[model samples]
Target: MSRRWSLRGKEIAVDDEDVVPAGLPERLFATDRFPCERINMYSTIDFLLCVRDALNGTEEMAMLLRSCFGTLFRFPVRRVLMGKVIHGMLTRQVLTKKKYELWPVFGGNPFRFSLVEFGEVTGLPCDEFEEGYSIDYELPATEENYAYWERLIGPDRDATIADLVAMVLGDTGMPASRKLRLCLIIIVDGVLVPTSQIQKPSLKHVNLVKNIKNFLAFQWGRESFAWAIRTMKPCPKKLRQKTLRILGFPLALQLVAFELIPHMQG
Candidate 1:
């Protein structure tokens, strides 16, 4: 049934089905969408899911994966720890090894990667592998992603995470994704020198139900924070130590004990 008339300003309503509700955060992203690659909340896992779904010919699953980004892209910051983790993941992406060097299908220009210098074998027998390798990059903007990120963030710089959380929670009119990207940039660069990390108090309102570290530890389980720290930037010793502790020194020790101690002759 058709509505009698659509109200000009008030007719539009929130789609009850969508995860993110209609709100100011929606308006913010609507103003200017993120230009570069935007990862799903599950990120690499989401990419794997898309690839898996595509393999299974489940088009709708790809759509579902596309829709699963973290809610921080909307209004106030909710999952602070998740936000930080995402920021770390994005930062890791920021400094990715140039893949085009290995796979010419990226199509920008020929370049060499220090890690895998195979020289110019453009017309050689080895070029067959490039075709197989290119299959792994079926998604759009596969390598251009690195270029877009390179432009958005510079090496040895700080991302705007704290300010972003502050803005989203405050009365600011900035896009949440943009804020998160800025934070990612800082996190990517934050390793060089530790700026004041996000204020824990500000995030207290977000996940009050669980202890943040415990929750993250449950998720990270056996992984060490060293990887995050290395990507975020090397900091002062105290800051590094603090990061290690926050990232999960106890869990790390447990992993080491379980895997290493059992094997040691001592």
Candidate 2:
């Protein structure tokens, strides 16, 4: 049977019950429950299906998210109506590789997801972010969204985010994680900023940035994103002449959420 549930204002028709089905897809259909999850699984399997070593057959990645991403929410999974549109699930502590909150009181980027630690949280100001990056109020405020997303990933259970992620995505070799880290390299020229000090970008980062729009356009495979990237050239100038483009916070958050699948496959 099909049922309609309004998830964060978007009307979604869920098939069968809300239980995230037990396995990755043999093939994709219109009725997949977790839309983004379904597509990611499909893409991963489809792209790397033939390569045996590339994937961890029985212990696949999504399976890991299912097993390790425990139920922190109090309500029964079945009892819940619309799934909470977690605003900063990517930026929240549990999702972080470091397993703790480093939120800046001055309102940091709530969606900044990384395999390891955040560059820095809020309140403590840094010169690098103020000079280098820019903020997009475009991504919705995550304060209200945090209630539903509270401890969704269980940050404190004595497992490294990488280990659990490897357990979840079944990436025993951990290639994707490495690739993700590489992509996350901020290309700043001659600034000599220490890796230890990172800051929140307010739409303009100093030194340099990544060609995030182009990267995201390829990753999401959405025309709208490509259109927006092509049409919008908000921050054009960079300190260095040879850099590609600046990576935006929103896309960086997405990279954390999706991990290195797109980087590996695409």
Candidate 3:
């Protein structure tokens, strides 16, 4: 016999022997519960697009970026759809020990997204790489790293995403190589694996891109997928807050949803 269950007012049929996951909530949050006024999700699409435009007519610089970023530089930004998918996934989230799962509101089987899927969807490199290349791997605090940070940012304070955008867009007479490095950092810290600090570009990212070849070889897909998973993990304090701030790459999640759920394209 099958039993009907209501989750946030949506009814679905379940087997009599089916049991809810141990840590899952009895009632999922309503799909409409996300408040537009309170949610602060940031995107760097405009900044990146402007940078792309600025590089127009410069064949050499453009080719360099294409070689490094692949399709990530061309990732389309659909703000509305991204928000909807992110909210839906968060509301319907199912927590597990290893990874997180999302139960589609449209009544499909729960699914888990991993680095492999992320790489497939984004066309980023996902192969195993050296530990030093990993996003989470902190570089040693050396004078060279400090000098690089100072050259890009400043001597006094940490630079924010807004600051990077200005430098990339403005004609500060920066070299093509330096600008290219900055652009990659903007993509990673500003868009792909953003944190709650208003998408502040990490100094580590700045250091990683110093060697353009090595930076391009890094497994960005794996690191980004891991960051996104970490961001979506259940948090009691976050759930209680009125202003919800989501970290990581919600845009990637939206893209994956479009591929997996064909109906979402409509």
Q: Residue-wise lDDT of candidate 2 within 18-95, one digit each (tens)? A: 323444222211222222210000011111121222333434333322321111111122321111212222112211
Lowest-scoring 10 consecutive residues by lDDT in candidate 1? Answer: 116-125
lDDT of each: 0.25, 0.23, 0.62
What's the TM for model 1? Answer: 0.19
Ten-residue segment with the worst summed lDDT in candidate 2? 37-46
- Error in Å for residue 206 of model 3: 1.8
Say which candidate scores most in lDDT.
3
- Taking the tens digit of each residue's C-alpha lDDT, what string does model 1 give over 19-57? 122221211112223123321221111222222322233
Native-to-model Cα distance after best TM-score fit, residue 241 in candidate 2, in Å: 1.7
Highest-TM-score candidate: 3
Evaluated against the true structure, the overall lDDT of model 3 is 0.62
Per-residue lDDT of model 3, residues 1-266, tens digit only: 56543322346565553444444443345445533323446655565675675566676356745663556665655443665567666665554444543333345345445564566567777677675555566657678767888876667346787777788778658787777777778778887677655777676777777787887787777667666666655464465456556666656666666666667666
The runs of at least 3 residues in candidate 2 whose Cα sits more than 4 Å from the true structure, single-residue gaps closed, are 1-55, 58-143, 155-219, 223-242, 246-266
Between candidates 1 and 2, name the one with more favorable TM-score: 2
TM-score of 3: 0.73
lDDT of 3 at 5: 32
Per-model TM-score versus the true fold: 0.19, 0.20, 0.73
